[model samples]
Target chain A: MLLGAWGIALFLAGWEVVGQTGALGMSCPPLSAVLAVLADPARALLFQRALGATLGAVATGYGLGLVFGVVAAAAGHLLPGMRGGLDRTSSVIHAIPSVALAPLLILSLGRQATPAALAGINTYFILYVATSSGLAGTSPVLRDLMSVLGAGRWMRFVRIDLPAALPTLVSGMRMAAPGALIGAIIGEWFGASRGVGVIILNAMQNFQIPLLWSMVLLTVMISLTLFWLLGAMQLGAARRYR
Target chain B: MPTAVRVAGVSKRFRLDGGADFLALDRVSVSIGAGEFVALLGPSGCGKSTLLRLVAALEEPSEGQVTVAGSAPGELARAHRLGVAFQDHALLPWLDVTANIGLPFRVAGRAVDRARVSALIGLVGLAGFEAAKPRQLSGGMRQRVAIARALVLRPDVLLLDEPFGALDAVTRRQMNIELQRIWSEQGTTTLLVTHDVREALFLADRIVVLSPRPGRVARELVVPFARPRDAAVMRTEAFHRLADELTDALGGGA
Candidate 1:
């Protein structure tokens, strides 16, 4: 753990050095200047609003995606007739890259809704695959025991499969955290009213180096924070379930 | 008296990857009377567990039939009147002892009878460990918890497929004694499948030995020991003689 912390610290120091020495172009600003811009009260308000809008999209998309993914997987699992079809359909949907998905989503759902829509779509595939495999991953011995005990389909799902699948499902959620954030930011670039993505794009065009760096750093921090939280949850579930 | 379970000329054939049917059991039959304990003894790959699975409705006979309580095995199971424990304890890792035992009630869509769950926990000698998970318990304790879970619903029939098979010899012997006492108290009609000669001899009222390779019953003997038998019986000359006799019968006369 200490080694990892040292690694990250050293990387940050390298970034600071590269910026301060103007080793890169003028677009590269020192870490201190970015912090200074973020600390300014007026700029802080804009950052706060951008962060809030992006977080709202991420949270909404994540929650809906999680529910839909789990439900779809369960449906396929309990009804074996649907398993092959559902699997094929989900795979085909996932094959379409999210980059290509942005325009279609914007055309259909409009600018503000596209961000959440894309986030949900990105989160869905990860969680669906995780939950499906997790359901199948429970012990055959346990399945036989339940059958002998005369458990109905729903009972087996609720009492056994769901709890057993929790660790894997939480792991998928952790992985989806960053993917969902990226989806939201990319969707924002296609003409959302206000967000960190829009600010970053505008700052880059205007050569506002410190503000652009601050926006990217903020985006990275949010993704890292959500990832860390979900990672901890996944660990807890693993300890409890396994 | 009505028979508790009937395996009427049951046969099981597994389909290999090449689509050829490999016969596991052939024209095997057994009967257990109401409130009786019968052990299906056989060598490994003798399909003894398959026979029990047929009775538990976990498998369909490739030919022939299994009936429990004058109806199909699935009937009794669907009515929430069947209980089973496997070689592995097969306890849900998330649930504590009390909750595991009460799982049957919940699965059966009945209220969780707290008193019955507690009583079974105590009966299994796991009273203090009511809140302990399966992983926290020893092998014997986990088996006991599995047995407790099996009996929680007070099913019409109980199926045990080597319930103590995973334990060490000493722990297995000790668990047999506990099981004997527990069975004497409840008298749940049981079909126990195992490879241990002494285990079948000690716990079963009657022992049916099966031959391997297209499994069939080789021989059967009604145990002459009386009720509530103590471990002292195992030390007797008769117990030794019978154990030796059954062991020899199972030595594959091929």
Candidate 2:
């Protein structure tokens, strides 16, 4: 943890130096300039609206995807016949680039719903793959014990496989958090009226370097915080379940 | 004595990953009477564990049949009348000792019998360690929890597959004595599979010695020691004589 903090400090120092020197060109701004734009009281409402919109999509999509993925994975585990089919379908969905899917989603679901749709799809694929493989990894010895104890299929699933899969599922949730945000941002670029992604698109096109940098920094902060929290949860699950 | 478990003319064959069939047990037969303790003793790879698995309904005999309480092994298991413990102990790492011992009741969809579970915990001398996880305990303690779990439901048949095989010699001997006491109290029919001749002689009412690979019963000896026998019985001249005789039988069959 100390090493990670040191690395982050070093990275921010390097970024500030590059911006101050203007070595990367006029587009790069100093870290102080970006922080100034973020702190300005004049832009608080704008930042709030954008942050709220994007977070709303992320929460909805991530929650729906998690529930769907877990249910699907459980179905595959309980019914061996459905496993091959679920695997193929998830792989096919994940194969198509989200960038390509965004325009199609906008036409069908409209601009307001597009960001959430993309995030849901991205989270679904990741969680489905993680949960299915995790469920498959139940210990052979434990399975034998459950059998000798006369556990039924549902009983074995509840008592053995679910707890066994917890660590991996938590890891999947960590990865999915950042992935959902990325999907929501990409969806916003197509035509959403307000979001961090909209600010980024306009700032880039208008050459508002500080605004662009500030939005990017905020996104990274959100993603990192979520990643760290879930990583802690994964550690706890491994300690208990493994 | 009424037979509680019967492996009649049983044969077991396993299909290896390379597609070749390996015979484990060949036409082996053994009968365990109700309330009797029997040990199937052999060298490593002699298929004694395979016979135990067959009776535990973990595997199907390629030929012949295994029955418990005059019904199929699977039937007894489904009825939640069979208990088992392996060398691995197979305790769930997430559960505490009390929960682990009470797992059979949960599996059988029956109410968790709190009084019975606490009684078995005391019976196995693990009264204070009820809330401890399996990882927090020593190897011997883990096996004690497993034995208590096996006896939790008052199973009609208890199958022990090298339950102490992984323990040190001293711990193994201590466990044998403890097991003898518990078995005497429960009087549950039991079949133990082990490679240790001394363990078989010390714990079993009768010993069935099996040959090395492609296992078949080579000899049977009835233990003459009285009930509630202690560690002192193991030091008797008769015990050593029987152990040596069985050791020779194992060697000769190999």
Best by TM-score: 2
DockQ of every predicted complex: 0.89, 0.87
lDDT (Cα, 0-100) at A11 in candidate 1: 88
Error of 1 at A32 (Å): 1.4
- The TM-score measured for candidate 1 stands at 0.98
DockQ of the two-chain complex in candidate 1? 0.89
What's the TM-score of chain B for every model shown? 0.98, 0.98
Task: Compose the digit string of candidate 2's lDDT tens values, residues B6-35.
Answer: 989999999999999999999999999999
Q: Could you tell me the TM-score of chain A in candidate 1?
A: 0.97
Residue B152 CA displacement from its true place in model 2, Å: 0.4
**lDDT (Cα, tens digit) per residue for candidate 2, span A1-242:** 99999998998898899999999998888898999999999999999999999999888999988988988999999999999999899889889999888889999999999889888998998899889989999989889888888888899999999999998998899899999999889989999999989999999999998999999999999898989988999899989998
Name the docking class for model 2.
high
lDDT of each: 0.91, 0.92
Candidate 2, position A211, lDDT? 97
